[model samples]
Target: MALPTHFDSLYIGGSWVKPIGGETSAVINPATEEVIGKAPVGTGADADAAIAAARDAFDHGPWPKMAWRERAGVLQQLHDALMTRKEEIVQLCVAEAGSIVPVASIMQFDMAMDGLQYYIHQIERREFVTPSSVSAHTNWATGGETLGSTVKVYEPLGVSVGITAYNYPFFLNLAKLGPALASGCTFILKPAPQTPLEALILGDIASEVGLPPGVFSIVTGGADVGEKLTTDPRVDQISFTGSDKIGAMIQAQAAPTLKRVTLELGGKSAMIVCEDADLEQAAFAGLINLTNQCGQGCVLQTRQLVHNAIKGQYIEMLKAMASQVKLGNPADPDTGMGPLISAAQRERVLAFIEQGKADGNTLVCGGTIPPGMDSGFFIEPTIFDCPNNSTAIAQEEIFGPVVCVIGFDTEEEAIAIANDSQYGLSGGVFSQDPGKAYRIGMKMRTGGVLINGGGGRLNPSVPFGGYKRSGIGREYGEEGLNEYLEIKVIDFRAA
Candidate 1:
C-alpha cells in the first residue's frame, strides 16, 4: 500500500476541518529518523473547537440521546472495519512509530480488535439509566416513622480528552475510549506524535462505521497541543498515558479548573527471578518483554531482581538472550525489535547508560548502539549489573531497551526491592513454587502481577489501571464505563 505523506487538518465533528491556527509536525520514522509523513499540528484554538464539538455531542447532541443498541451497532461496525484493515493499520503503525511489525501484527492489532469486540459484547449486559434496587414496597424506619424514597439515574460526563503515548496506541485508545463511548460520552483523541497515523486512521474508520457527527474526533500534535487539550475546561475528563513528569504537569494545570484526570504514568517495574525458576526460559522471556517495542512501553520491566545464589547463571543466560534481539527495519517480519522514537530519545538512553557507569554499575551485555545499525536512533538491548536497588539504572525509567540486574539475598529482600519504587504499574515473578510466586505477586503492590510470564489481557470486560500515581481510574471494564457517567438519585416518594 502506498502511504500518504500528509493529512491536511484535524478530524472533528465528523469532518476533516481547517483549524483556526493549525501547525504541522513531520512524523519521523524512528527506524531511520526520517520524516516519512506529517500530521496536523493543533493549537489551543484547535483543541478548543474539538473539545467544544465533543462537549456538544456528549451533553446535547445526538450521541447523548442515541440508544445503547445504536451505539453498540456502531461500535461493532467500527470493529469490523478496523478488522478488515488490520494489515494496513499494522503497516501504518510500523512506519509511523518504528513499531515492530511482528509484535504490532500479533499483539497490538489483534488485542485492540478484541477490546472493541468486547465492548460490543457489553451492550447486551448493560441496562441504561438504572434505578436503585428495592425489595420492601412499604415505607419503613428504624425507631421513628419515616417516608421511603427511591433513586434512579445515569448519564454521560460530556466531552473527554484522550492522550496516548508512543507505545500501544490502538490498545490504549480502546481501553480509554471504549468505556467513555459506552457511557454516551464524546471523545477528542490525541495520539502520540510518534504514532498519529494509526489514530487518524482510527477516526476515519469510525466515521465510516457510522459514528455520529461530533461523537468522535482526533487532533494530532506535540506537547503544546497536548497541554491545550488537557487545560481546556470544556473537556470533562483528561485520560493520559505517558511519563510521570508530564502527568504531574497535567495534574497541576488541571487542578485550577478541577478537571477529572486519569494518568497512566511511568514505571520501573521489577521482574523477580527466584531460585527454583527456569533460568534460561525466564531470562529469554524477560529480555523479550523488556526490550519489546524498543522499550518504549512505560510498564516495561526495566529492573530485574534476581536471587543471589543463581544471579550469575541468570546473568549469563540473560546476556545470551539479549544478544538474540535483532533490531532492524520495522517492515521486516522477523525483526523482534526496532529503533527508539527519535535521535533525542536515543541520546537520552545513552546518557542514562553513562550515568549507570558513573554510579558503579557493570555493563553486562549491550551498552553501545548495535554494531552496524548506526544511522538510525538505535540503541542496543543493553543490560547493566547494578545489583543495588537504588542505582540510577535500576530505579529510573530509561524508556529504552536497557535492563538493570540487581541481586537479592532473600525472599524478604526481593519483595523489599520490588516495592521500593514511587510508581507501581506491572510486575512479574518467576518461581517453581507457585505458592511463593502468588504470594509475592499479591504483596508487590501493582495494578497487575504475573506469576511467570506476565501478560496484559486488557479485556474490555476487565478493569485495568495502576495504583500510587500510576493512574487515577480504571479502563476496559464495567468500572471503566462508569467514569464517563454521572450518577443521579431521583427521589421517588414511596407511600
Candidate 2:
C-alpha cells in the first residue's frame, strides 16, 4: 500500500483542510536520520476549528443519538478498515516512531486493533440505561407517596480531545478514540509532532467509514495546539498520554474549564526478583526495558530490584542478556532494539547516563553509542548498578534503552524500594511460587502487577493505568469506556 499524500493537510470536520498558517514540520526517521515525511503544523486557529467541529457534532449531530447497535456497526467497519491496512500501518510506525518491525507489528498495530474491537464489543453489549427499585417517600404537601422507580442513564460527555505521545502513536490514539466514540462522544486527536501519519490515516478511515461530520478530527502540531485543545471550554473532556511534567501542565490548564481529564503519564516502574525466583526467567525479563520500544514505554520495568542473596549472579545474567541485544535499523526484522525517537532524545538519555556515573553508580555495560552506527539516533542497551535507589538514574524516567539494577536485602525492602518512587504504573514480581509472587505484588502501589511475565502478553480486558503521579484515570476495559460517559438519574412518581 502506498502512503497517503494528504500529510500536508489537517483532517478537520470530516474534510482534508490546509492549516491556517500553512506551515509544515519534517518527520524524521530515527533509524536513518532522514526526512521520511512532512506533517502539517496546525495553529491555534486550527485547534479552535477542530474543537468547534466536535462541539457542533455533539450538540447537533446524529452520532450521539444513534442506537448502540448502529454505533457498533460503524466501529466494526473501522476495525475492518484498519485491519485491511495493517501492513501499511506497521510500515508507517517503523518509519515514524522508530519502532522495530516486530514490535511495530504487534504493539503498535495489532494491539490497537484489538483495543478497537474491545470497544466495539462493549458498545454491542453494554447497557446505556438501567432501572432502580421503587422507593417510598413522605411528602409534606401531599401524604406519603410511593415513587414508581428511577433509571440511571449513562450519556456521552460531549466533545473530547486526545493528546497522544510518540512512543505508541496508533495504540494511544485509539485508546482514547475507541472509548470516546463508543460512548457517543465526538473526539479530536492531536497526535505528537514526531509521528502524525497514523493519525491522519485514521482520519481517512473515519471518512471512508462515513463517520458523521465533526464526529472525529485530527490536528497535528506542537505544544500550541495542545494548549488550545486543553484550555478550550467547548471541549468537555481531555485525555492525554505523555510525560508527568506535561500531564501536570495540561491538568492545570484544564482547571478553569473543569474539563474531565484522564492522564496516562510517565512511570519509573520496578521489577522485583525474589530470592526464590527462577533466575533464568527473571534475567530475561530484565531485557523488557531495552527491547520494548527502546525503553520509551511508560509502563516498561526500567528499575530491576534484585535480592541481595543472588544479586551478583543476577547482574551477570542481566549484563549477558543486554549484551546480546541487536541495535540497528528498526526496519530490519532481526533487529532486537531500535534507536531513540530523535537526536535530542538521545542526548537527553546520554545526559542521564553521565549523571548516573557522577552519582557513583557502577556502569554494568552498554552506555555509549554502538560502534559503526554513526548516522542514526542509536544507543547501547545500557545498564547501571546503583549504590542506592536515591540516585538520579534510579529515580528519574530515562525513557531510553537503559536499566538500573538496585540491590535489596529482603522482600519487604524490595517492596519499599519499589513503592518509594513517585510513579506507580505497572510492576512485575518473579517467583517460582505463585503464592509468594502474589503476596509481594499485592503490597506494591502500582495499578497493575505481572507475575512471571504475564505470559508475555497484554490483556485488553484488564484495565491499564496507574496510581499516584503515574496517572489519574485508567485506560482499556469497561472502566476505560466509562471515562467518556456522564451519569444521570431520572426519577418517576407512582400513578
Candidate 3:
C-alpha cells in the first residue's frame, strides 16, 4: 500500500488535467518535515474551469435528473472503492495531514465512510416532493371561484463548492461531498494547500467509480483559488470549514451573487465536570482535546470547567493522563499524539502558551517542544490552570495540544462559564445522574453536547454544526442533505 509520490494534475470534468498555470507546490510530511510529494497548484483559471464544468453538469446533467436510488447505487460504489483502499488512505493521511494512526484511521477515514453511508441511507428514505392540502376560495365581489393543489419540490441548488480545512482533510471533504452529491448537486472541492494529496486521491476514486463528468472536481491551491470559486456567480452554494475570520471573508465574497453558504467554523468548546461526576472518567475524557488529532479539531473540548469540589483530584488525574500520551511520528500505531500541521502552527500554539503565562494562568505541565523531538513540528501537551474563562487561552482556538482548566463553584456557574464564549460548537457534561447531565447539556449554548462521552462515539445521523458565531447551517443527517437543496412550489388549478 505505497502512497503516491506526486499528485501532478487536477481532476476536473472527470479527467486528470494539468493546472492552467502549470505551477506546483511541495507537499510536506508534517511529522517528518520532509517533502512527501508535489501537488498541482491551481489558479483562478482552474477554478473557473471547475465551476463551469459543475454549472454545466447541474444545468443539463443526468446525475441531477436520475432517480434517487440510481444515485445511491453510484455512491455505494464509491464507498466500496474507498473501503478497498482504506489502509493506503490512512497512510496518506498520516503523511499529508499529520494525523496519527488512530486518528487517521478512525477520525479521518472510517468516519468519512460512515458519513457517506449515512447519506446513502437517507437518500432512500427522503422524499424530495411533498403535496399540500388542496383548498378553494371564492371572491364574492367578482363571483370568482378557484380550486388548486400545491406541491413543494426540493431540487438541487446547482453547483456547490466546498473549501475544507487542513486538520481533517478527508473527513471534512466527505462531510461536504456526501451531502452535496446525495442531494444531486455537482461539487467542486478546494482543499487546503498543505494537505491536497488525499483530496487528489479522492478525485482518482471518484473518477474510477464512474462518476459523471462535471459532477465532481478537485482544484487545489491557496486562498486566491478559493476567492475565485466564492466570487463566481455560477456556483450556487459554498460550504466552507475553517477559521471564523476566513468564514466571514467567504460570506462577504459570496454576497453579491447571493450564493448560499454553510460555514463550519472554529470552536473553543468546554467540558463541564459536575461535582457528582466520576472523576476518573472525566479526567480521561478531558484528555481527548490533547490526544485526538493533537487538539486540532474545531469541536474538541479545550476548555475544562471542573467543579471546585473535585478540582484538585481531577487536575492531578489530567496531569497523569497527559504525561502518558506518546507524541512522535504519526505513523506509529501506538502514538497517542502527533505534531501540529506545520512549524507555523507550532509557533502559534507556543505563542498562546506564552500568553497564558503572561495572563497569569498557572502552567500545570508541558509548555515547550518535547525532549528528543526536534526534526518535526512537535509540541508537548500543554495544560493551564486558569483563574477565569476570560483569558486568551481560554477563549481563542489554539488548534493544538493545549488545554485550559477553569474551576467553577457551582453547576450554574459551570453552565455560565461554558456559554460565556463567542463559540458554541460542541461541549460535554459529566455527571453520575443522567438527568442532571441532560439538564445542563440542554442549557449550554452549543450545537452538540456529549453526556458521559456519549459512549465515545459519533453518530452520523445526528446533525453536527455550531450555534451563534461558531457557524451557520449544519452538516450530517437530514439537515445536511437539505443544505444543498432548494424548494420550489407548483400550483395546479382545475376548471
Candidate 4:
C-alpha cells in the first residue's frame, strides 16, 4: 500500500484538472511536524467551476434522471473499488490526518465504506414516490372542495456543497456523499486543506466508475473556496462538519440564498457513572474514549460526572487507565493515542488545561507533555478534578486528550451537570440498575445516549447528530437520507 507524496491537481467535473490559481500548500504530518506532501489550494474560481458543474448536472444531466437502481449500481461499484483500496486508504488516512492506525482503519476507512453500503441498502428498498389519499375538504379554503388523491414524491435538492472537517476527513465527507448521491443530488466537496488528498482520490474513483461528469466534484482550497461554495446562489444545500463557530458562520452566510444546511459541530459530551454502576468498568470505558482519537472526536465523553459514593474509586481507576494509553506515531498500531492535528491545536489544548489550573481544578494525572516526545504535537492523556460543572473546563469543548471529572451527589445533580454544556451530541450513563439507567437516559438532553458501555459502537442505521448548539439535523439512517431530499405533492383531482 504505497502512498503518493504529492497531489498536483484538483478533482472537478469528474476529471483531474489543474487548479485555476497556481498556489499550493504543504500537508504537514502531525507526528513529525514535517511536510509530508503538498496539494493545490482551491481558489474562488475553482469553487465556482465545481458549483457550476454540480448545478448543471442536477438541473440538466443524466444522473438525477437515472433510475434509483441505476444510481445504486454506481454506488455499488464505488463500494467495491473502495474495498479494494482499503489498505492504501488506511495508510493515507493515518499519514495525512494523524489518526492512529486502529482508529483510522475502522472509523475513518471501514465506517466510510459501511456508510456507502448503508445508503445502497436504503435505495434498494425505497420507493421514490408514494401515493396516498388527500382530503379535499382540508384545501377548501384555498380552492373548491372535492374528493382527491395525491402522490408524495421525494426529489433531489439540486446541487449540494459538502464542507468537511479535518479530524475525520474522509469519513465526514463520505457521510454526506453517500446520502446526497443516493437521493439523486449532485455534489461538490470542499475538502479540509490539511487532508485533501483522500477526497481527491475519491473523485478519481468516481470517474473510474463512470459517474457522469459534474455529478461529483472535489474543490480543494482554504476559506475563500468555502465562502464561494456557501454563498453561491446555484448551490441548493450545504452539509458541513466542523466547529460550532464555523458552523454558525456557514449558516449565516448561506442564509441569503435560503439554502438548506445540515451542520455536525463540536461537542463536550458527558459520561455519568451512577451510584449503582460498576466503577471499574465505567471508569475504564469512559477514560479510553476520552483519549481515543487523541480526544478529537465530537461524540467522545470528555466530561465525566461520577456519583460521590464512588468518585474516589472511579478517579483512581480512571488515572490508572489513562496511564496505560501510549501516545506516539499514528502509523504505529500499538500507539494508543497520537499527536494533535497541529502545533497550534496542541497549544489550544494546553491553554485549556492552564485555564483548568487557574480555576482551582485539581490536576489528577498526565497534564504535561510526554517524555522524549519533543518533536511531534503530543500531549499526555490528562484528567482534572473540576471544581464544578459551571467552569469552562467542564462545559466547553477541549479538542485534545484531556478529560474533566466532576462529582455529583444525586441522579438529579448528575443529569444537571451533564446537561449544562452548550453541546448535546452524545452521552452515556453507566449503572447496574437497568431501570434507573433507562430512566436517566430518557431524561438526558443529548441526541444520542448510551446506557452503560454503549457510546462507541458503530451502527450505520441509527441517526447521528446533536441537540442545541452541537449541531442541526441528523447525518445517518433514514433521517440522513431525508436531509438531501425534497418533498412534493401531485394532485390527481387537478389532473
Q: Pick the candidate with the highest lDDT.
A: 3
- After superposition, the stretches of candidate 4 with alpha carbons farther than 4 Å from their true spots are 1-5, 134-146
Error of 2 at 353 (Å): 0.2
Q: For residues 1-495, could you state the per-residue lDDT of candidate 4 as single tens digits?
A: 455658888888888888988778898888988888888888999999888888888888999888899899999998998899899888888888899998889999888888999999999898989999656564556775667788999988899889998899989889989999999999998888778887877876798799999999988888899999999899999999999999999999999999999999999998999888988889878777778878888988999999888889998898998888878998988888888888888899999999999999999998788989988889989989986987778888889988888999999999988888899998899999988998998888999988888745578998999999999999889999999999998877743
- Lowest-sum lDDT 10-residue window in model 4: 133-142
What TM-score quantifies how close candidate 1 is to the native fold? 0.94
Would you list the clashing residue pairs of candidate 3?
none
lDDT of 3 by residue, 1-495 (tens): 465759779999899999989999999998899999999999999999999999999899899998998999999999999999999999889988989888888989999999999999999788889999988878466679887788999998899999999999999999999999999999999999889887888887898788999999999988889999999999899999999999999999999999999999999999999999999999999988667888899999999999988998998999999999888898988888988899999999999999999999999999999988979899999889999999899999999989999999988999999999999999999999999999999999999999988756668998899998899999987888889999999988754
Candidate lDDT values, in order: 0.80, 0.91, 0.91, 0.88
Q: Return whichever of 1 and 2 wins on lDDT.
A: 2
Q: What lDDT tens digits, residue by residue, belong to model 2 across residues 1-495?
A: 575834789999999999999998888889998988888999999999999999999999999999998999999999998899899889999988999998899988888888989999988988889989887787667876656788999998899999999998988998899999999999999999888887888877889899999999999988898999999999999999999999999999999999999999999999999889899889898887656898899999999999989989999998888888888998999899988998999999999999999999999998899999998899999989987899998889999988998999988999999998999998999999999999999999999998998866677787999999999998999899889999999988865
For this target, which candidate reaches the highest TM-score against the unseen true structure?
2
Estimated TM-score for each candidate: 0.94, 0.98, 0.97, 0.97
| RMSD, candidate 4, Å | 1.9
* TM-score of decoy 4: 0.97
What order do you get sorting by TM-score, best first? 2, 3, 4, 1
Residue-by-residue lDDT tens digits, candidate 1, 229-348 = 877778778888888888899898788888888888888888899999988868976787667889888777888899989999888988887787778988888787888888888899
- Residue pairs of candidate 2 with colliding backbone atoms: none
